[model samples]
Target: MASSPLGHPTRGTTGTNRLRRNDRWIAASAAFRTAADPLVIDLGFGASGVTAFELATRLTKVRADAEVIGFELDPARVATAQAQLDDVRAGRTNFSPDLRVSFAHGGFEVPLPAGRRPAAIRAMNVLRQYDEADVPDAWASMAARLSPGGMLFEGTCDEIGRIASWVDVSSAGEPERFTLSLRLAELERPGIIAERLPKALIHRNVPGERIHDLLTALDREWERAAPLSTFGATQRFLAAVTALKRLGWPVIGGRSRWRLGELTVPWDSVAPR
Candidate 1:
């Protein structure tokens, strides 16, 4: 018999645009944009394949050759997604029938046919159910399956996609950057993302940890930028993130990205301990 999938099952809860924020990030990433193969993987795609469809839709806007494959250890979930794919192929859904997407039965191993390697892997909200210590192995197993110059985008997000954070790990299975993305509408403190951190850093949110310090400083800057709230939450967030840069935080990206409520920093800035 074939070996079983390498990871556990997720809650199987998902929606049409639950991962739209992450989809945008991947679409803009260098890995997906420059991949010769341009094949992407959606690990632990949960109950619906809609996120994969949305991902393919968004990515194709930038690279028409982009393709997406959704993976799940639960054979039932794979079947469910396949059914959705059927509808799309039949032009019964909002997605294009020509969109390149598929669903497969697999887990962290991220099996691909013809010995193909993926350009990027998006594992949103999949690791939250796993123990914090299990992260390295999972990251390694999945990252190793990536093509050179490719990355593994793994992280967690809330049900409505309002709050989220993820890590960009290289093919070597080492994290390169950490990012926090929020909706920024009627927003509260940026620290609200503390509840949705990736498995590697969720428990590290206590004092003395770099992740903890980052959230504290994030909230402090947001409060100081309160006066900008009159202009708009986006402006307020931009001011807060700019302040982070001024304070010598290794903040990445620019005004264009900050305007979208995303704050990216070097992984060392908030790595555990």
Candidate 2:
């Protein structure tokens, strides 16, 4: 595997199930269901491989042959995660056999053992350290390693995974959708997702931009849906998404997804104006 010239290490703060929302999204994704080679990459999976292992466990439900590989720029981080995998495989840990996870040291090129392209590449909280201007190159680098019909999910989230927003990019390198997943009960406003927007939309959240307008509209709908709060936070969130859709916004997904505090909008809806 080749190393990156622009390697920026992270603080490496990670916990068990820290990326559960993302895992859920991927497990329900069409990419996983239609993938011929069921190989997924957990790019920059911090100092531990638990998140990748957890994703593998969930993915297996969608595709029994699914496997996850954790990629890191830091070779030491890969080594540490590998040791943990060894312990789990030796019956010293509670991890299941279905969680067939491995670790590799590589950059955006995503060097796999058999020169395989991945069905999905998830790069979360990995590019926050770089300037927003560096996003395109990074996206291009990872997208190039995807299988023909593959997808790339890149985003940022709070430490505990309560709020998250990500962009799904196709193997052609065009971003397809922008999705926000939150914890609705205590959500101050739907605009909270602005803080977790992916690189493509993060800097573009300023006034006059489509992303800014989308957030503003979301906050307004959330307020309008306050009546549903009596039913429950989930109900209130569903109402907000319903409102947005009725208002002619290109909201994707149905009530089933909205019930989980998730709302997906077409990329064109919030793309930079």
Which prediction has the highest lDDT against the true structure?
1
| Residues 1-273, model 2: lDDT tens digits | 444523578777788878999999988888877999989999999989889888998899888899999988888889999999988888787778547789988778788767789999999988877888888888888898899989999998998999988889899888899999998888878898888888778888889999999889889988998888889888888888888899999999899999888989889988887
Top-TM-score candidate index? 1
**Cα lDDT for residue 85, candidate 2:** 94
Question: lDDT per residue, candidate 1, 80-119, as tens digits?
Answer: 9999999999999989999999999999988887789999
Query: Over the full model, what C-alpha lDDT does candidate 2 score relative to the true structure?
Result: 0.87
True lDDT of residue 73, candidate 2 = 80
lDDT of model number 1: 0.94
Off by over 4 Å in 1: none
